[model samples]
Target: MSPLGRPVSLGGGVANRGQVFRLGAAVRRPVTPHSPATHALLRHLSRAGFDGAPRLLSADDRMEMLSWIPGVAARNPLPGWSLSDASLVSVAVLVRRFHDAVRGFDGGPHHWPRPVPPAYSDGLVGHNDLHPGNIVFDGERAVGLIDFDLAGPSGVVWDLATVARCWCPLVADADLPDGFVQGPERRYDRLVMLLDAYGLNRAGRVAVAESLVDNHDWTYRIVTDAASAGHPGFREYWAGVAARTSRARQWAVDHQAELIKAVRR
Candidate 1:
């Protein structure tokens, strides 16, 4: 059991929801920018009328209290619930809302715990990792986003690419699960729809698509490096299916032009 009221499970730092635990009335970890940023981000979301994140309670000795989001996280390849139109739309809308909410807050001058590779020049900060597991779903709809560990000042386009990479998933058709492979064009179409829903301009779309190509290798390297430095969560993740996707990154590079055209169209 964690300082929170329930047993703690490791979150993917992006899409997978944090393990469920009961709320504890104490702060379990030392207060730092990392923890406070979660609080600030959550407060911003709440103030902006988005209710899909954990509610930050005052610090406790054992843990920071946050409201548990009850739903399944849409992990990689996206289980059935997240493949639908409704879930994609909801994800786009919610992330847009979250970005809007955080637009005004200062990230303060604190040093971030992790390396946040710069992408493009959009004013909004990037959530960085928008993998399927970070998104919580109720049936066929996205209800919340979790694990703000990588949130930082970044280009909005970068954030979009991260989301698209996981959701629209620019991998080779063969790399996709059976359900997604059957409707390749539909997936592309959904990418377009999600972009439109986020209210991105043509320039933003182009930047995001390009970034997806340019950043794939760098991002993978960073994840691998982090894992080697004794970050247990990342080490475990990299040791899993992600390590096997070396070819996938090469594929992205090989087909950059085609992917850009698909997303742009």
Candidate 2:
């Protein structure tokens, strides 16, 4: 058996989460401004019976420890399996369950990170960043979510919008990985599949579509700001993706109607 407490570095992104290390049955990572709030949220999630999120173990000023969820998190140059329709639907289902599980959570006490606009703050503390890297999968099932750095109170539609943006993808053709290439129709169908799997109503579908542009803008600002502040990972990642992201923002604007129609259908 592997030695207990031996540091096994995990890879998911170019940021801090990428720098996380597994020590036996626990994960240790640098503390952020949002760490305390996230710990509180994790505690609440545990009490609320959500097993998909990590349990808060312990913390100090520099780092916090969490139960190491057992599953593979697909990293960059995402695997073909991670982009399959089955994986897409599974993650949608997981997000829905997470939303329902946080129904009675009180987020007022902790200052959560990444506040959405007041319009989309529907009192639900959601995992705003549901990209494949943050999701843990066992077979085709999305068994757990790992990152809480961007978790905060937001409308379920906004959260789902972020999902659709990343998964349906709402990106320029040039930005898609080999496994993600699809015609516009296929992309629209995937968006519909995702929303349908999540059990969104017509109103929710429309709201999610409308939120996509804002979501793109919001996400771009956050990354650019972090890069501006010289966050090493963000700086490096952003350097390579800045042009691609600009195209994605434009893509969201151009395809808003099609996305709305697809989800509504």
Candidate 3:
């Protein structure tokens, strides 16, 4: 039940399997047990006045329609617009708003689309992935977020950390976009600014920094494993994109101490 006339593009992530189609202005995923939970969350977010996500339309025979959000998604190395301080701050704010919006929604009874690893901290749902491509930007500003296929109950701080890893990057200099590599200090400052904008407490800050290191390996393993399983999107993405993510991961690991000091300063 995607929008009525928009074209559908295939080949992205493994989780996106099962015939994703676009109708006029919506993208639809086939109906499954997880759909109820996803739909419920989407409905709650929409009702809570968070306009940075899709509007859920009723389910059809095999799909559900979600209102199309217009903007470009910053996939990798990110476009310059996504690297600006303004965009980073906007993203932090938007994610914080979304977390607040869904604070009361229940996921206990429904089956989630993906596994929820252990909670990164006590009160946050594991927002497992908040990478750039999942976020929509409008000229150095985050206008919306797409892809909730992995959202589940976990720590709020952990979720924030996930966002930082992508927006602030926290990756090695060589792995960053050329402009960012030239000014790692400024990029580090942006990460701090993003944290401040999100109003994270000291504990949240620590969790974010630590998660960048801890989750890097786990996240990569998950993607690579999924790719090996013959998931078309992931397989294609791994062949062309994931190999480079390892470099970024190594960059984060190598510079953890420096990044922690910078962010905490």
lDDT of each: 0.68, 0.84, 0.74
All candidates: TM-score: 0.82, 0.94, 0.88
Kindly report which residue pairs in candidate 2 clash with one another: none
RMSD to the hidden true structure, all candidates: 3.6, 1.9, 2.7
Tens-place lDDT digits, model 1, residues 49-116 = 77877667666544555666778888875666577777788889988877877787666553445544
Candidate number with the higher lDDT (1 or 3): 3
Worst 10 residues of 1 by lDDT: 21-30
- Model 3 CA deviation exceeding 4 Å by range: 1-3, 6-19, 31-33, 119-121, 179-182
* Count of backbone clashes, every candidate in sequence: 23, 0, 18
**Pairing residues by index, what is the TM-score of model 2?**
0.94
Q: In angstroms, how far off is 53's CA in candidate 3?
A: 1.2
Whole-model alpha-carbon lDDT for candidate 3: 0.74
Highest TM-score, which number? Answer: 2
Model 2 weakest lDDT span, ten residues long: 176-185
- Candidate 2 lDDT score at position 103: 87
